[model samples]
Target: MFGDLTGIMGKLKETQKKIEETKKRLDSVLIDESSSDGLLKITITANRQIKAVDIAPSLFEDREQLEDYLVITLNKAIEKATKVNEAELASVAKDGMPNIPGMDMFK
Candidate 1:
C-alpha cells in the first residue's frame, strides 16, 4: 500500500508540473474575436491576456458605441480563451491522473 501511495504521489507531482507547463503554453495561444459588424477586433491569449485591439474609424464617431463594441468583443474573446484554457488544463490533469479505486474524478 505504501508503494502504491508513493507512486500516486509521484504521479500527482508530475501532473502538477504538466499543468504549469500547459498554462505557460497557453500564454502564447491567441484567440481572436470581433464585433458582429466587424468594426471591432480583439486578440487575446488563452491565458486571458489582451494582445491587441483594432477598431474601425467609423466607430470613433460615437464614444458610447465604441465602448459597447469593445465590451462585447472583449467578453467574447475572454469566453473563448477561458474555454481553451480549461480544456487544455483538464486534459493534462485527466491524462496524468493515476487510476485508483473510487478516484475517477474525470468521469
Candidate 2:
C-alpha cells in the first residue's frame, strides 16, 4: 500500500510538471485567425491578447458597413483564435490526463 501511494504521488508530481510546461509553451504560441471575406485578420497569443488586426481599406467605403464588418470580423477572428487556444491546451492536458475523459477544464 505504501509503495502504491508513493507511486501515485510521483505520477501526480509528473503530471503537474507537464501541465506547467504546457502552460509555458502555450503562452508563447500564437494563433493567427482571419475572417471569411479576408477583409480583416488578427494574430493572438494563446493567452487571448490581440497582437494585430488587419483591415482592408476597401471596406471603409461605407462607414456603417465598415463598422458592422469590423465587429463581425473581429468577433470571428477572436472566436477562432480562442478555439485554437482551447485545442492546444486540450492536447497538452490530454497528454497528462489520458485516463480522465474530456477533462478540458484546464484549457
Candidate 3:
C-alpha cells in the first residue's frame, strides 16, 4: 500500500542522514602514530588522509636510516587509520540495520 511505502521512504531518509553524519565524524577523527624510537610522528585522519608528518632533526644524520623509519612509521600509521575507519563504518552499518532473525550469525 502507499502508506507502507511512505513509511519505508521516511526510514530510508533517516538512515541516509545518519550515514552522512558518521562520514563527517570520521573525517574529523585524527589518528596519531609514532615510530619506535619516537623520532618520527605522523598524523592521519580516519579516512586515511595524511594530515602531517614530523621527523626529529637528529634523524637527518643518516639518510638510509631516516628512510627506513619513515617507511615503517608511515605503513603502521596507515594500517592503524584504516582499521579504525573500518570499525567506525561497521558500527554505523550495525546501528542502521534492522534486528532481523539469524542476523547474529552474520555479525
Candidate 4:
C-alpha cells in the first residue's frame, strides 16, 4: 500500500511539472491577425491576452467604420489565440497522459 501511494505521488509530481512547462509555453505564444481589408491588426497571446492593436490612420475620422473593423479584427485575433492555446494544451495532455481516453476530443 505504501508503494502504491508513493507511485501515485510520483505521477502527481510529474504531472505538476508538465503543467508548469505547458503554462510557460502558452504565456510565451503570440499570434497576429489582421482584418480582411488590411486596415486593422491585433496581436494576442495564446493565453488570450491582447498585447497590441494597430489601426489605419484614415479610419480615425470615422468612428462607425473604425468600430466595425475593430470588432471584426478583435474577434479574429481572439479566435486565433484560442485555437493556439487549445492545440498547445492538447499536446501537453497527450504527452503527459497517454493513458487517458478520448484525449483527441480536446483537438
Candidate 4 local Cα displacement, residue 34, angstroms: 0.3
- Over 4 Å off, model 4: 98-107
Better of 1 and 4 by lDDT: 1
Each candidate's TM vs. the true structure? 0.97, 0.66, 0.79, 0.81
Comparing 1 with 3 on lDDT, the higher-scoring candidate is 1
Q: Model 1 over residues 16-107: C-alpha lDDT tens digits?
A: 99999999999999999999889999999999999999999999999999999998899999999999999999999999999999989898
- lDDT by residue (1-107, candidate 4, tens digit) is 68776775777678778877887888788899998888898989988889989999999999999999988888988898999888877777656653434545544
Query: For candidate 2, what is the lDDT?
Result: 0.71
Candidate 2 Cα misplacement greater than 4 A, ranges: 60-63, 98-107
Clashing residue pairs for model 4? none
Please, what are the lDDT tens digits per residue for candidate 2 over residues 52-100?
Answer: 8887888778888778876886677667767877776677655665343
Instruction: Name the best candidate (by TM-score).
Output: 1
Structure candidate 1, residue pairs in collision: none
